[model samples]
Target: MQTAVGVFGGEGYKDGIEVPPLMVANAGQSDRPEISSLNCPPFVAVELCREHLGVHPCDRRRSINEYRSLFPAIDFSLIENDDDVLWKADTREKNEEVAARGLKFLSWLWTRKEKEIAIVTHSGFLYHTLSAFGSDCHPSVKDEICKHFANCELRSVVIIDRSMMGSDPATTNYPGKIPSGLDLPSDVADEKLPDEGKVN
Candidate 1:
């Protein structure tokens, strides 16, 4: 995740990168103060995101924050208050619940008017969350990005339903789902990129 963000722009990075400032799409938005808080090993997605984000305590060179910290990048504002972790995963959580949360997140992004953004995430969880947006991919960009993102790879995508993005998405405000009978379509998903044709 950090690697993905770093590629856009970070300390020690040369100026004139393509993307805009990065925002992390954490696998599980748990704000645990220590690894012990996680109890078991930091699950696959958690571990990988920490590794690249420079927040993992085990790897000093890679770690920037203490543990499970996303400072100097993802501000506290983006996260939910208290221990109500945004994307925290739970064993008892139902797939429908997960899908609802994922859809709400997409809607939140839409509310923020985020056209293009960066996501710091791992494979399994990526699919797990994105799959909820809809069963299928948006036809136009699907071919370009394919099914999933490869290791530390980059791709661009567009939202299909444009409604799924409604914190709980506006679409839910009224009706028996879209006319298609599917939740608004969205892609698994970038950081801030400089305005094109502009010379820095």
Candidate 2:
């Protein structure tokens, strides 16, 4: 049995928003403090970004390191860059390709040893991935997930003794289940980028 936790990045500034380099550099720093609280080992952290965004796995690591530097009290290895997985694709195909990739990533995680794992991906991947688990997906669920994603959301779906719990049985929610509003720090600002051109 393992626990799967999904965290979506917060609202980023719009293009031409004129954010300082320091601001852009400091974007994901807040997540580090929050992520350090998890009691999991051999942690599997997945960073899901859109291919068009120009973000890379190295950028994700920098954010992770920033968090670690701020909170050295947290005891857990990052499993190195090799252990980190980056899933990049078009957001337009979020309902199909992105969701499929998210599911495939989760399935692959299940095959590994049972341990607590964390996935940090885009909101589109999170929403659609949970939707694909069922024959019919609901609009309300999508709305709910979208609202959560609007902020820096962190959801958890626990697999209990081989049985998945917390996921929407109706296939309403993506990434299996959507947890309650994440208990993130108040200081953490929303850092999501604006939805410009769709992923082509």
* lDDT (0 to 1) per candidate: 0.39, 0.41
lDDT of 1 at 34: 15
Model 2 stretches astray by more than 4 angstroms: 1-40, 47-95, 136-148, 158-200
After superposition, the stretches of candidate 1 with alpha carbons farther than 4 Å from their true spots are 11-70, 81-96, 133-146, 160-200
Candidate 1 lDDT by residue in tens digits, 76-100: 3433233333222333445455446
Model 1: residue 74 alpha-carbon error in angstroms: 3.1
Scored by TM-score, the top model is 1
Per-residue C-alpha lDDT of model 2 across residues 1-200, encoded as one tens digit per residue: 01121222223445554322211222344332222222323323444332212234432334456534433333235334532244333223324766667766666667766576565556666666665543342444334444435445567755332245544454323344544443222222132223432386
Q: How many residue pairs clash in each candidate?
A: 15, 11
How does candidate 2 score on lDDT? 0.41
Cα shift from native, residue 8, model 2 (Å) = 15
Best by lDDT: 2
